[model samples]
Target: MVDSLSELMIILNRTYKEGNVFKKVVKQIPEVEAAKIGEISKRISKAKQTVFEATAHLDRQVWQETKTSAQQGRIAAEATRKTAHDIRARVIDLQQETSEGHDKLSSQVDQFRSQMVDAADQMGDQLAQTKRQITKDGEERKQFEAGLQRLVDALPASIHEQLQSALYQFVADAIVQRQLFALPSNIISPNSPPLPLVQYAQVLSESDIINLLQTPDPIGDADRILRKESLMSDEALGYATLLRQKRQFKEWLSSDWPSLVLVDGCSRGESVGRTSPMSFFTASFASTLIRAETGIVLQFFCGHHIDPQKENSGPKGLLRSIISQLILYPKSYNLSLNFVDQGLYDAVAASNTEALCYFFEKLFWQIQPDTIIYVLIDSVSDFESDLHDYGERMDRVLILFQTLIGQVLQGFAAGPKLKLFMTSPNRSHRLIYRVDQAKESIRLNAAALGDISRSGERSLREIRRARSPLSYIM
Candidate 1:
């Protein structure tokens, strides 16, 4: 019994030691110095950023609770938009007045010409008197009479030609010369009395057009179509800009066009494309007014004949490539037609202004053109935008287009080297041209004529072949 008791007590002691030790271990966590140090290290830099972000979040919440800043933003943008719209309208008004002035000036030229011709009779009489006074004997008188006859035969047809010769004679006579006319500041400032579209519409009228047309004019069988651009209709507006690069071009040429002759597109490292560069250089050098010779041609494929369906990319690339070729080989160069999609159509269709801006940013620099041209064709039968009827202007569409033009114009303002040329897509788009708070009719008299073809055919035949007596129009 003593041995069994001793064995039982030893077994009980062993079980207690194993079970109690395991319980102690399960109840407590072991300490680690390395883990502590690592966790402390987290507070060094990365954690500092988190702390800063948290503090910023807290500060933002406090500011949102305490302060008001609703009107600060978009202040400049609103002002800018208002200014632009105002300027656009003003430009149109001024341009119309300027056109009238041009017509008046042309008429004045004709009257001036008549006066000069009238003075020719007086000049003949003076010559006869002078000839008689200079004659000494029969032989001298005969020669003087012959010279006077020659003078009568050699009378100039144009007043300008006469004045030029007269000026030469005055110079020979040692007479002090002065200009006869001093043009008004309005005559010279194309940008003056600048009115926005709203301001222009407020004052413009049919009377203005009639008055402008009354100025002295040459007789022409064809009724002239006044070319104009529709600023409000553009969906995407593209502007190409080039600074005074002639200075750099000069510097480049001095270095034998080393930097000017690059070949690569993406991987090009400070190298100019030789083929295009060469052609550009050759033509430019020949054409530049650097010396006595004026090297460029005056003709333009100025007419619009581009296929609407074509992207204008292939044609543009081909045109550029040909120019490059011409540069590679020096010769007399003339660009028969300027491919002028420039950017209006594309910018209008762009999903956002950012795309349009980025597009023009490169394009403007690449073409380095002196004049920018915009062409839009309007057909009565053409499909209208899904949002508007054929004759109506949609405000939403206008707003979108206005936004685009604003962006493009801002790009242009940054670089005035680019002069924008724009054309309305169609004469039938009276929605854009008719005078009201919205449409300015002077830019287009077509709308005033009214729709002759109910079927949307704009041809003369459509009017002449009208099935109804009421369809006839002048």
Candidate 2:
């Protein structure tokens, strides 16, 4: 039993040692598990660190963007404020300029209105002045016309008075008296009541003479000649001679009774020669009268041909030509009338019988007071061969002569001693008998002219030898 107990003790000791070793191994395993867990925890920590860094970077970028956007918005607001201020200033300037312009326009309108009023006032004054001027001119013209009328009326009257005065002076100064021929007893007696002196003319009415002249017929040789019709007609043959005298005197009065006078015979048939008996006698008488008076003017106008049948041989043409000559005479004579103004000379020279009377009246009024005039008409019947035409022409002349004679006589208290002398180729002239109350009709032959020229100076035979036709005797 002892031995068996010993062996069991040994085995128990060995098992106890093995159990201690297993306990040690279990403790070491637990330590190793704890170390592994520590390593895994370190790895997880590093991953979390990386994720945090990335999130921080994204947040920083977002903050920077927000700041830049806010700054740009503020700058835009400032620029808008500046633009608004500039626009306000411009509006204020425009209003001020408009106000100034309106005021200037108003001032100009006022000035223009003042100027218009002044112009209207001036126009009214000018109109009044023009009206006054027109009124003044009208009054002056009326006065001028009145003066002209007075002058015209006085002209003839003054001339008649002057001629009467001249005649009176001449009568007082003249010593020798030349008398007209004594009247024949058969024709007119000293006591015969002046048979109506106008009865000598077949047609005494002035109207009849006018009618004859106005009738439109050619003035032919037959009209101018003393045809059988005229001789056989109721009118006396001497009527033509009276008619001729009338026309000659009327023309002479119109011519202002020229200082130079011409007396002529316008005979038809070859009577004596060309010289007129009346002309020769007048020339001799004038020569004698001129010796007595220094202021007497005398001239002779003669016809071209004694025969009326010859061409251009009328007394009318010769008389007109003589007046033209006087008109053209240079005003060299001391006593010549001043006719240079208003073409007076030419106008008077060209005037017809009526106009000539007016001109003569005016001209004669201006002549010297002492001038004496003597007019002698010869062979009045010789004016035209046709007695009827000659009588017609003479009617107007006779009326004019009557007027002039009456005016001259009226101008003087004692009656102007004016004398008229006439000669006719025909002895049958009734006018001579009718007109000459104080004188007689003397038959003046060619020989009678010589007797007057050399009366008591030459023998009758010598005078006969010297005598030619009446025309040559002058």
Candidate 3:
């Protein structure tokens, strides 16, 4: 018990020593060192008592924590083992279910395979039956066709020919009517060949239908059918356009007569003109002028069938038309009346527009004072465009034409001046300005001029605002 108290004393002393403030206060008591040492002894006793109680409480807490921790660990281990056992049971069940499903699938596969075999056999029988039916139908068709052919062969040649002719005529009529309605009159060509379908009708309509009956050459018939089918397709709308142009021509003649008139809108690029290009328009214009017989319509429709080249300025057809007229009516041009029958004009000399220019001027001067000479030169731009060097050829031609007209006007102190009319694509070109700058440029009737002026100014303003100065040069 004494040794125990001694150990308790040491424990108490160590606990007090660790409390540095209390130890320092106790040690600094210099005046009452003995009394302070006694108080330290009392403190040591109290501290020992307190340490004994704290030790007992700590020991109890450690024992409780250890027991609780051991119980928790044992419970966690039990739960883990139970969960693993459940998972193993589930795995076994899944394996058994998978085996059963696999067996069922195998059975199903066997049943499906048997069904597929049965279906295949049935399909094979059906296909064979179908093929046999098709063969029977083909044989019947061939027999029927042969019998019909024989009957046709027995018919009289004259009867067959009449029937063939009637059939072809019917077909031709139907095609022509159908093509006429297919497009608007303004878009179609009035002059193109009747539907190439006509040729097929011709095969029947021709004198050779009897030959077809006599020969029965299947290969030749097949070739003809193929050729008919391959014939070039209808490229232009017809009937309506012809009618419309004719009507328009009548209206123009009634309105503008006796005065030298210029038919100027002739560019493909100029949207302001008729949607139909100059080529199409000129045909109608020339046709009307010819029919009118108002005066000579000297037409120079350059680049009509040929590519625009320098040599294509005046087509030979133009020269022919002019020469023919001069020969037929030499008196019309103030030449001696005898010259008409003799065809005295030098055909070689009047071959081109340049050579024929003098003749044209004389003809212009001599026309009946009341009759206006309409000079229709359509799509001059097409020829001008191809001239390159920026319309140099056209520039020279314009100058020559101007000089010729000036001389003609001076020579013909009387009446019937050549109505010098031409067209350009737009206002940017020199030709448009050159003609525009002329003293007696054809004036648009008053109201029309005002509308054109306002529209032109508006267009110019928009163009100027939209485009740069450099683009103007181009």
Residue range 1-474, candidate 2, lDDT tens digits: 234345445434443545465222333334544554454456556666867887788778777877887788788888889889999998899899989989989999999999999999999999999999999999999999999778757789878688779999898555212111111222221221221222222322323222322322111221222122222221222222222234443353234322212222232232324333333433433444444553332233222223445322333323332233223323322222332223333333343343334333333333333344444445555553454244433433443434445444455211112234455544424344335332233332333333232322333233234331112222
Best-to-worst order by lDDT is 3, 2, 1
Better of 1 and 2 by lDDT: 2
User: What TM-score against the true fold does each predicted structure earn?
Assistant: 0.19, 0.32, 0.32
Tens digit of lDDT per residue, candidate 3, span 296-415? 555554434234343322333333344334334324222322111111133223333343333333333334444455555545555445343325545545554455444445553333
Which sections of candidate 1 miss by over 4 Å? Answer: 1-71, 133-474
Q: Could you give candidate 1's per-residue lDDT for residues 1-474 as a string of tens digits? A: 344446545544543545465233234333453354344555455667888999999999988865544454467678989999999999999999999999999999999999999899899999998877766466687898999778766875585577779989988555211111122222122211222222222332323322322311211100111111111111110000010112332342233111211111111111122111111212222223223222211111101212334322112311222222222222232221121132422332432233233222333332222222111111211222333232222222223223333333554322113211111222324333321322112122222224233333333333223321112211
How big is the positional error of residue 123 in model 1, measured in Å on the Cα after superposition?
A: 1.3
Off by over 4 Å in 3: 1-31, 158-474
Deviation from truth (RMSD, Å), model 1 = 34.9
Task: Give me the candidate number with maximum lDDT.
Answer: 3
Quantify all predictions' global Cα lDDT against the true fold: 0.32, 0.40, 0.45
> Worst ten-residue run, lDDT, model 3?
232-241
